[model samples]
Target: MSSTSIIKVQVDDTQFKSFLDLYQEYQEHLESAPDDWKKVGDAIGDAGADMEDFADASKASKEFLLIAATQSEIISREIRKASAANNALLESLTKNVTAQKSFADQAERSEKHMKELKKGASEFAHEIFGLGSFLMRLGALGGSLAGLGGLLSGIGLKDLASSAVDTQRSARGLGMTPGQLTAFNQDFGTRYLDPGVLGSISSAQSSFSGRMWLARAAGENMGQVAGEDPGQLAANLAIRAHNWWVNTPASMRTAEVLQSTGFTQSGFNLNLMKQLGNTPLAELQRAAAQYGSDQGRFNVSDRNTDAWYGFLRQIKDAGNFIETHLTNKLSDLAGPLQHFADAVGKDVTVLIDQIFTPANLNALEDGINGFTKYLGSSQFQQDMKDFAGLVAAVAGAMRKAARFLGIDTSPSSSTNPASIPVNPGLDPDEVQRETRGQVRGYGGVSFADKALGYTRHKLNMPSDPRAVLAEMDAKNGLPAGTLEAMWAKESSEGKNLVGPVLRNGDQAIGDLQFTGAAWKDWGKGGDRWNFMDEAKSGGAYMGFLSKRYQGDIAKALAAYDWGRNVDKTIAQNGANWQKGLPAESMDYIKIAKILNSQKQNVRVTVQNSTAARVAVQIMRPQPNEHFYRLSVSV
Candidate 1:
């Protein structure tokens, strides 16, 4: 399988803003006037009651009454100061939370990238190990050859061959004519073959050396005369014949050559002599060489008595060792050769094992440790964090610019960083004109002027539709509760983005239930996104929809659900537009209409108990009042 690289999850500015908004809301709720504030007032009142009772019981204790009044005033002042301090703290916490979340995002990307690098390094180490093992095996083969070569050097082939060759006599004995013998002797003296080969054979003092010499001679001569390459068996026989011919005394040379040619004295053959005489000189020499070469074939060099034979002993002993101990089963090996082989093999095997032992594996550990050291260093970590921060900052500026120009620059879940929006379409002015539209609210006030915080009454919507809708309306001029209610009807505000695929197998994504094509065209540019990105895409598209349908939310929503078909139906049917559309489209329109109707009853308001509101309420008291009432009645 091909290696898998780690993926980075990008969160753009638009997405961060959405998450920040939600988190801020939760933090606001937490920092609101805690329920225990009432208990402080109740405690003061009880203390005041006790003081009054003590004064009454003591008849003339004005000092106790004065002390009680002073303490109450001081406690009330401290409470006000604490309330102010809490609001400041909440603001500080908000900023820290945003930065920490961004840092966490950077960390995740670094971890995934490191994982990919580690996997690649592991594969490389495995390949290196395999190469090391092969080299070790090759070393073993070389060691075996070196041992055999050492034994061969002990045999003195050079000294023997120097004294042995009488090339002229030997060549003439083989019946080479006077001219032929002279040429042969000249080639022998110049060491055309090997000058020391004759001495090496003579030192062996065995039939085996004689056979080896003749075989070598025949092979050399055969290549010269007929260009016929001799096999191992033919070469062995021919060299032996040459060894015998070269060693014989000069006077007996011709007789030995004739005897080798199959001419026998017991036969007393004048006819044989006549037959030999009839033969041409070249034919007679060739016949004699062949007869002597063939006779040498039966000689066994290593088995017969021979002088100190270093080369032959080394070759013979090593071949036997391999056959008995190495190639064959271990149990079948015998004698000192087997014991020597076992000792060498064991030593080599142990060496190989040591190379890969746990102690040695520290070398491999050092490699991985070095990789991790670089990855986890402060400099590297800071670089990654700084890069993420830079991207977020740049993205924020781009998003702000895009928003000003009315482009839907939002987060996309595409892992490819290139797909993230930097600067979107050309013509910012035209884009703004197409995107943003004026939104009017109750009594002709701009949507931006209206506050929906007061309308946070309980509702059955999946989330707080009034609060979110009001915020969108004020900030982006969306019809209040329109996007929220549309979301409630479409996908319960993105709760089902990953599930409940359409019967046609198309997945509805984001709060507005954008199909794949709709998301591509208007929602945002990505294959996937978090809930915050989905919300931004859904909100951005709603603004564009408002512009397209001339600020008629109901019809624009109908078009959003029905696509171009709604426009076509309306054009053809006029007053009966709903009738001309498909049943699914008609049902979609009904659902959107129902949502629109429900949002009408929802008052545009915010949660009354927010920290800022509670603090203001606490600070505002009647000017003449020395004591403020605490509502501990509940």
Candidate 2:
């Protein structure tokens, strides 16, 4: 109970050892996204379904209008040609009313059918007036209707003046002023996405479908469910109604909104659904939800359908397309991860259960002693010999990933740096400068540590450029993480394989984006297609630049971007060399500050003088490496 004590720790849990254990547990696998994400997918899907229905109805109404107009014109032409008495005869034939009169009746029927079609279509469109974001997505195909963009299409929309009048009349029926409808339509998507609307909107029941669902949920007559209501049905209300329709644990998956909540948007999946033309909506949704897992769409009979469930099924169908690259990505890693585990002599088996360090190395332990004792052992020698092929395998995977991003990979062949064809384009004077020593390839025990560190720290990359980046920085005597952060800013850590490939300027590729000319000179010995090799070549070049600039990071980076032209830039700006650099080069220097923080190494307390020791490590122990311990205390 001393108040002056330096540290006082409170235990929240009796068995808690370290916070890292909790972090490792939670970080083990990807978990389900929050309910808010699911709701977003629901909003998109449900609104899309409404728009799809409206699109179908609008299309039908216009077709009827076009045909009716064509019929009217034909009748008028015939009437002009007819004699007065024959016109009466023609009317008698059409009805036994004349043929012209009968045709006129058909036109009237068509007009009536057009209005009916527009009426139903208006209801769906009006309901979806609350989902403007989904409408914008549809507008990618045809412009948004809110701004009369759909009304202005040069494509097949024949009755603009009449449709506008009908829309105005429908707005009046919904008790919304023209101005209010525009304002309401503009903000519907936002309202649907908000959870707070649930309490207030539940009391304001509106549309027939909304009324029907409310009636069913409360066991009341559909006629009586209309409480002072708004005509628009929000996404949340539809979801609530679906839950009410199917509330049981065993059957909730059969609910419409539950089926609809997934990533595939309507526009993205249109062609997919068209492929299975006339496939049942239930079957399509069921197949799509099964891609990642069976999130069930149509297991129950059609009798389970709620009144508004038809639109909900279409919403779920949109989500069924499920465009994702995660499965392929995971499959790509299975081989590399397994091979690496095997290469490490099985001591690295089962992550989270063991502290994984690369074994069979020449590294000294216990500290830094008996180094290279393992190198003499025959087993350890085989590991070293096998390493070249392992490196090739990992490099091959990196190459594959690079190719996936459409990078024209640089070739890896010539081993000797001297054989690299000289680039006459490089500043000949700078090329001749002292490099201090030959550039080092990451081989030996140090490489093993770095590669394993990448797997432990960064996840899933077959090889991380950061490790290579660190070595590249060191070659120039630049700080560790300096190049890594710059590359992160440059090419998003090599996710962007090539830049300016399409531009009619200097083509660039890989993380550092060494131009074809630059690669020819500085990168001749390395594979521009391979990230690690690209880093080494790029780092060496930057090192050359660093020496020329007297270790001024800004000067070195500016020169890297501007090339030989940076000298002219420096000459122009005089003392303010930074202002002379391009906007991008100045932006590149900002990450140096970012990487500076990364280079601020966190010093951990290490016990050096031994208080305890062990005879064996109990790992896949090498013949001479029997002196492994769990921990040595000082």
Candidate 3:
């Protein structure tokens, strides 16, 4: 620990070089030495033990030990300093490494941006060149047009050209050749002259000349008509002209002919005068006057019958055209068009039937039938059937169409359901009673009269039985004590008869009375049981009574009695009762209730035999002659 102690150490060039090299190397090693600290510490610890083991040696060992101790001390101090320097260098190096990575990432992003810019520039250049090529083609076409001197040779352009320096001015004065004028005239004539219009036109020469001028004007402005062959244009134009003449108004016909022939308004007037000077204005005026007079009164009524006949002829002709010319010509487009034809055919059939009267309807039917046979002979039976059904549907639609047209014939009822007979006046009750008796008799009842009698007797009873019994008397055709007497009879029977017989009798009586009440009330005035009305009103009442008794026997019997009475009444009065109360309506509610209750009761009885047995055993204990609360909780 003394600062005065001289520690001898050997040093030479190699050692000094080693020391200098090692010093620099040590600086580097120190920078990385934190990685090796644990190994360095272990070596230092071993050296201290080696120094102690040599203590047993002589004076020479003592001298060596002193040098070794000083050397160890110096080495240990250097190791500690190197360890601190190495840690500091390592921390600095980590910061430099992170900074380098950040720079590299920024460089990569800049490189990617440059690549996208280059791609965009390449596309912009390509579009510019493509536009340049299109402009060059247009420029070349213009130059070629300017060089066409041969085509303009016949026009005496040099003389006119001096007077009109501009090319447009010179071209405007040019005239068409005789052939061209004639071709123009023919084209306009065909276009404007439909058969009907041609038939009406006066001053034929003027009409023809006007048409010629109009065609020339149209050709000059619109180019030759599109979609027409050069050779066929003349023929097509002639047909078109004929159609125009047929359809055009008298005043407008001459003007349309002039316009189609290419004449200006002034030119048309001059040409018309030249063409028709010999025809006399009075004759033309007379013809026009006749046409004008017919305008409002114009009707095809005189020819309507013939027109319809002709219409049928036209339909047949068109159908034939479709099957022959069109089908063959447009074989590829035929499938869908054929389907359309079938639809149109069906619609046509319907139109005919609707427009025609019943007397005339048979003609339409015959036409349709004939068409069907035609279709059947071809490969379109399915198509025909579909068309026929559609036509049948439209038969009614034609009535609406006829109405719109102001035709006043009766609407055809070919497809309507058969009409029912009208009922004359008759007693509904008698009719219903007779009908009921018949139904009962059919069901093996021997006494039809007895059945009717029983039904009638039950019908007269009041709905509130207690009220009825309370008010009963000989005056009302019942004994004063009749109910009391009946009650006594019932009690006696209850004691003597088995449970089943008593219950059955009670059920039969209740059912009979319920049905009789329903039937009697069905047609009675003032809230009486109209079977139809009761059907709607009685739903809740029926449900309540069914749930109250925990059974539907009373409801079923009520329905049966109603059904029987209605049937008897219908048979007795026939058509008369049919008008009053429909026999079907009478039976409807009753039958439905009976069947529904039967199913429900059968299921209930099967599922709960005990309930069924109890119901059968207990006689529904006769409802008291006087109204009393009968409480039973389910």
Candidate 4:
């Protein structure tokens, strides 16, 4: 649909205003009449009482007073009855007025919608007429031709005409005009072609073109038929006939007319509108005015007037009965309800006041300030600062411990730092100097020396070479400190020889022979275990020996032989030793030979012990102590 075709209907401001005025007047009449009625009734009752009092006086006053009292009572009763009737009439009038106003508003909306629909329909008809005219003219122009060449020319023209008609027809059907169709065709091109048009033109180069010509002729003829206007004479005759039909009275009811009328009656009762009209606001006002002006006499004797007054009093009393009872009950309920309402109102008012007032906002600000003040207190600040400091201290200690353990302790510097080489080239002179200094005399210093030295310095111990070495041995799990402690304890017990003998014979012998030999071999040969080699292999050898010598005397002997051979080799070949060996050559030839020999010897000894009751003796001689021997035959 075109954007312009979308109708936006506006309400009639004047009609709305008039309806609003009527509504306001109706509401005012409804609200004010009850109080006015009550006031009038009260006045009438007061006047009647005054007249009655006068009527009860002496004979000279009796005649005038009785008439006055009678008239007063009559008038009071009439006035009260009139007020009540007027109140009822006013209430009904208000309701009718509201309904009428709503009806008027709805009628206005319906009228606006009707106008929009009529406008749309008129535009649609106009577009259809324009499209039909264009198609009819195009068809007539294209159809006047003959011969093969003429037929081809005619086919082309007819195809063009048919396409134009189809395009126009589609636009018109879709509620668009030729101008809009043209614009759409230009904007969207072949996209807007009717599917039938496209399919017809698709194979039209064959005999389908002839069929298309026939179809086009038929469509064009249909368009012409649709476009034709009826003769003026016929239109005039139709109008005259419609006027005559409308003017003529029905002699007898036709079936269609009867059905239509019955349908109308069923849908809406027309007589109801007429009846409502009779009791409309204007008619009711006229009736009320006439009733007031007539002043028709009701039975006016003194007794009758008294009776009427009594009747009115009874009616008034009846009306007031519920009100009186309600008033008493409501009076009882009023205090509590009013108190509750007051409390609710006060609470609502306080909430509103807090929402709108700056003072409450200031109180909120004060609360926030109090919280901030608490946060900023010396104790809180100090606690936070201490916590931060403690965290820093813990982090620093952790970093120091990691460094002491030779862990990678570098802090992350940046999220995307430049990638640096892990082993950047060192200065050749500095490397050579480090290498030469690192390779000391016959026994090369280890990487553990610096680590051990660091530990000793941190412990605030004397920088003795042996102390550092002892610490290194202990750190490497050699139990040197335990041996020293045991030796000291034995000396204190005057058992010096025992500790020495145990140390030299077994534990110390094992260390000096196995571990010491391995260290010597590592230093001399420049093998992986060689301390002179940058990649020290002694640690690796120890790990291997630890596994091999897991839990047997054979292992201890092997370790001792390994150490002895390593020490002997180091003593034989000085600093320049391992120069002739290939990179992949083994370092344990001598140790292996010694272990093999020891294994064979031990096996023979065990065999001999089993064959003969060989006695094994352990002898120890001490100064100022007897030599003792302990022997066991196995």
Candidate 5:
């Protein structure tokens, strides 16, 4: 471009380019604007064209403004609708969260209830077993009150079964012969309901039920098998197998054990029996492996022989027992039998798929709820009160008979073995005669008084020395009655009472008979061998032994008898700790175990029909080492 003319042309070109840029910017704005705004812009442009064509420009522009206002209102309405939809969604989400929390709370409460029910069931089972045994024993002894059986029946164990099974059904299931069923009803019914056996069954049930609840709570399968309380079935089978084995001739039993392990010890035999009694599934399997195929015991091919006939008879007897007690035509008793079995066995889990099926759990829940209501009822409490009064009446009648016979059943009457009532009543026939003989005999009182005074003072023990020992047991974590029995063996209540002096002439002294050497180190001082000193030192030593031997009571007691340096004594004694002990020491532990187990408790009172108080005395039997007895009135 030229200088003057070219400069003018260039400036015009630059202005044209700026105009093009503004046009491009306007087009871009039109493309990006809202559809409604574009419509408004188009109407405005049309209004402008109309104004350009017509005379009223103000009216046309007013019309265009009205259109734009209408478009703006539509856009505002749409925004408001979207906002309302979002608010509704937020509200729905909030409600859902609250509902979830409520559901979670309900679940938590359900779990807690289940836990409590399981615990309660276990405790109830234990008490029921104990009470049942007590009542059954009384019945067996011909002293059972009519109401005791009624009380157990009221608990309604029979109502739990709904699988169309009973004793009759069970017999059919087992394919039992009619003769076998008849025989079983006679023999098995008498034996199966024994108090001790019932106690074991109750224990098994508690274990099984507890495991079931625990597994369900953990969201795990309760048992490995279907259709059986595996624990109980195994235990029952094991028990039967053992009983059968044990009943065989001694030689046969010996051969079986030898075949299983090549060598045997008493401990091993005891352990084996215990295993059979406990009857874990694994143990059951092992028993089956060892004994399942043995036809020698069961062989009936030689029917003419006495042994063969006896074996057949025994089999028939056992079959009868099972058919009569555990099986029937109406309902299979297998379920109930298994229930009892599981109660006695260890490591029992509930048969979740079997006993704790949905239907059964529901029934249990209902039963528990109903029982809870019954317990709260006044009539139930009244029945318990009535039962207690009846027991008192029976006890009173017996006591009257005892007193008329002039038997001094008092706590302080005997000292060699403390007189405690084993069962308070007009003593059993044998006991009554013995008590009468003792009364007619001379010098029994004189001997007891002299021994009691010295022994009571020396031990710093109560008139009821056993009670004092029991208290010590609670305070020091010793098993009940262990220390008292130990004392009894050491001093026979401080002087061998009626027996010849049993001292080994080692100058042992005090209730526990600490040797001079041990007394020097532990009994405060050698010369000061007193009851308080002996107890403190002995307890500490026992604690040491417990820690060292991992609470094996037998081993600890053996070491105690062997003297100090228990480890050295154990080393010298080899495997049998009792080998080198003096006869008295050996005898001491043996007697101690028995004496410690002696339980004589009496809770009796006399109240007349007129509600007048009569003589109230509680007596326990004072049993000597030979279980010779004297009665005590407390």
Candidate 6:
């Protein structure tokens, strides 16, 4: 069941680019941190000078103060002690200022790193790219992420899935809001999401870049960029992408932009510079489209803006928030500065004598203690470090912009998925499994919805319907058209599956709408997908029931719908089993009679709501076997 669902994330992620811009702004923000910290040290020094001035003036007035005050020696000793501690506090402040400057300088210098992506960004890109590739690989098999894949991603209801953690905590974690990820999955047209997340059926962790992308896609109409105009949207993306490349110099195009697209399928793969790189917008859109039909065709560029400028706008916003946060935190140092200034701003004589008292000495002791703990607390240091690390990460991500941003157009053999996690739930999308290779001209939409839409087509009864019906007729040795009417009633000739993963027991599969339990119990151990297999297997069960019911076709059909337990109803009703039959089952017989010419072709479809299963799949045995097994097992 482990597979992947690719979002077809385009090249030139605007969110990522905006993140690059954030790196620039954050770098500027970090540069001032050292100087900002230096100002704090200077303020403390000025306060210290005020204390020294008071001490000097107090010495000049020492004789007068001795005349005015008792315990003069004690007062003198306290004055010396307080003055010495103030000096020590100033010296400690200077050292801290130097350390802060060093860290800020390093963070600032890291911004100048133009060639290499930092570790954080490298890790982020690895996960996102890995997840995308993982999805593509899983798309080959056809299952789902936690089996929630096709149903949720197909219809934009993936948001309903719970990200409940289980035995193992996830590797790459969820991004921000689950809603945004859901929107991104929908807008991005992804069926499967996340990697290496167990216990979670749908979502995986959102890496830093991924968080910004999902957030941007979810925010303020960003995900709605595909506004009801597919043709125009496709044209707009092509024009804008080409316009951005118009200013590019030959050297950059040759060195950087040439190999940008690589093997990644989505994004602006347009190469204006190359002699043969000219892929027309219409043709390019056509090539990228999943299915050829008008409704089914999906031009990745034409579909959504989560991969382009909208993403960039979000990155800029996030960067602004980070920059403002750092500057605001630094400005808070003014409070301590003002506190010290107020203490030293007092009048000379009264303050000088008061400064020698026990309370004032203790206050001085507090100020000195404040130099280490208040100015250089562990919390503040950690905050600075965290912000600095993030700021440095912005620079790291910027370096990768050149490599992944449509500069490389050549297809590579494979991608490096080492950085991405491997989630066991990664599986094929719901469409592939439900359709089972028979693409009905519908874009990879939900199979159940597809069937419901084709209700009229089923009622008309296409040529293919006769093939399975004839097989059932020949196998069961029953009257012709009996199974045809039944098939039409159940699923309009296999037009729909029960649910995406056959998740509901009431929902069934194949031409017969066989529940997992019924398929296993009566299908005679053949491929459930094959129409002949289902027909023959189903016919034998019907034949057996027909013999048991004394050649009564109506009684046998009822037994098929209500399970073997329907015998209780027949026994209770004695010779008149039809007396106990529900209206829904009675309709089933009447329609079969009409279609097969056992009676008139009155109604086009039959009603058999009593379809039941008495067993379940062995995977995780359910308590109630009568309740039936779900399609998720199938």
Worst 10-residue lDDT window, candidate 2? 434-443
- Compared with the true structure, what per-residue lDDT tens digits does model 1 show for residues 325-407? 55554344345445556767998999998798887799789988998898989988998976765566555655566577654
**In angstroms, how far off is 557's CA in candidate 5?**
1.6
lDDT of 3 by residue, 1-634 (tens): 6688579886667767777887898799789877689789889989887776665556677899999999999999999999999999999999999999999999899889989989998898676455445446646754554444334333433333332232222122222222222233332333322222221221221355543443453342222332222222333333333334445555665654655454332133323333333344444343334333332232233234344445446645755764575346456645655665686699899997878788677987999998877776755877675566556545545545656776543522323222322133322222222222122211122133233323443455445543344344222222233333332232231121111111111111221122333434432332222222222223323333334433433332232333334345446776564343445344433433433343322212323434433222212333211112334333
Per-residue CA lDDT of model 4 for 433-532, tens digit only, reads: 1111111222223224323322333344234434543454344333233223222222221121111111111111111111233335444444222111
lDDT of candidate 6 at residue 320, scale 0 to 100: 78
Choose 3 or 5, whichever is better by TM-score: 5
Error of 6 at 399 (Å): 31
Candidate 4 Cα errors over 4 Å, as ranges: 1-616, 619-630
User: Residue-wise lDDT of candidate 5 within 1-634, one digit each (tens)?
Assistant: 5655534342448888999999999999887789868799999999988877776767788899999999999999999999999999999999999999999999999999999999999899886575456445645644332354355345432221211123334334433322233233332223231212222322333456533432332223435312333222333434454554555565556535533431121112434444443444444454334233321222222223334345445645855774564335215535554655567453345444467678988999999999999999998999897676556655555555656665333432222332322333222221101111121221222233333334444556446656666666555555566677777665666553232111121234456655444556666652223455556666666556555666555556666665443455468977775675545346655844664467466444443676544555434333211222343323
lDDT of 3 at 598: 38
**C-alpha lDDT of all candidate models, in order:** 0.48, 0.50, 0.41, 0.41, 0.49, 0.49
Query: Residue 85: error of model 5 in Å?
Result: 99
* lDDT for each residue of candidate 2 in 1-634, tens digit (9 for 90 to 100): 6669688897676446567687667665335446657889999999999999999999999999999999999999887877677877876766754667778989999999999999999998766443444334545533333334344344213343334344455445654333333333333323222322322234335556555555543345656546422323332233333333344354443434332432011111222222233334343333223321311211222233232244444434544432234345446667654654464555545552444344523332532554466667888879886686468557666666667765445532325544434433333232211111121221112233334333332343336456667777766677567677767766677565445321112345566766556777887776555666667777787777667876666676767765665787688888977776645556667765665465443334455455565343234423212123353233
Error of 6 at 181 (Å): 19
Per-residue lDDT tens digits for candidate 6, residues 1-634, read: 8868667665868989999999999999899999999999999999999999999998979977777676677789899999999999999999999999999999887876733567667888786465445445545433433344455455433221222111011211332222223233332223211121111212211133322322232231323332212222223333334434555565665534433422011122334223113434444343224212322221222123333334445545765785686568547756654654464565565677867999988998999998768557888788886566555555444434534553332222333334333322222222112212222221222333333323423444446758767777767755567777777776666665342232221234666656555666777777454566667777787777767766667776766665543566678888887777645556666754574355333322333445553333334323211122343211
lDDT: the better of candidates 4 and 5: 5
Task: List the candidates ranked by TM-score, beginning with the highest.
Answer: 6, 2, 1, 5, 3, 4
Cand. 3 TM to true fold: 0.17
Report model 5's TM-score to 2 decimal places: 0.21
Error of 2 at 92 (Å): 99
User: How do the predictions measure up, each by TM-score?
Assistant: 0.23, 0.24, 0.17, 0.12, 0.21, 0.24
RMSD of 6: 50.5
Q: Candidate 2's C-alpha lDDT?
A: 0.50
Candidate closest to the true structure, highest lDDT: 2
lDDT of 4: 0.41
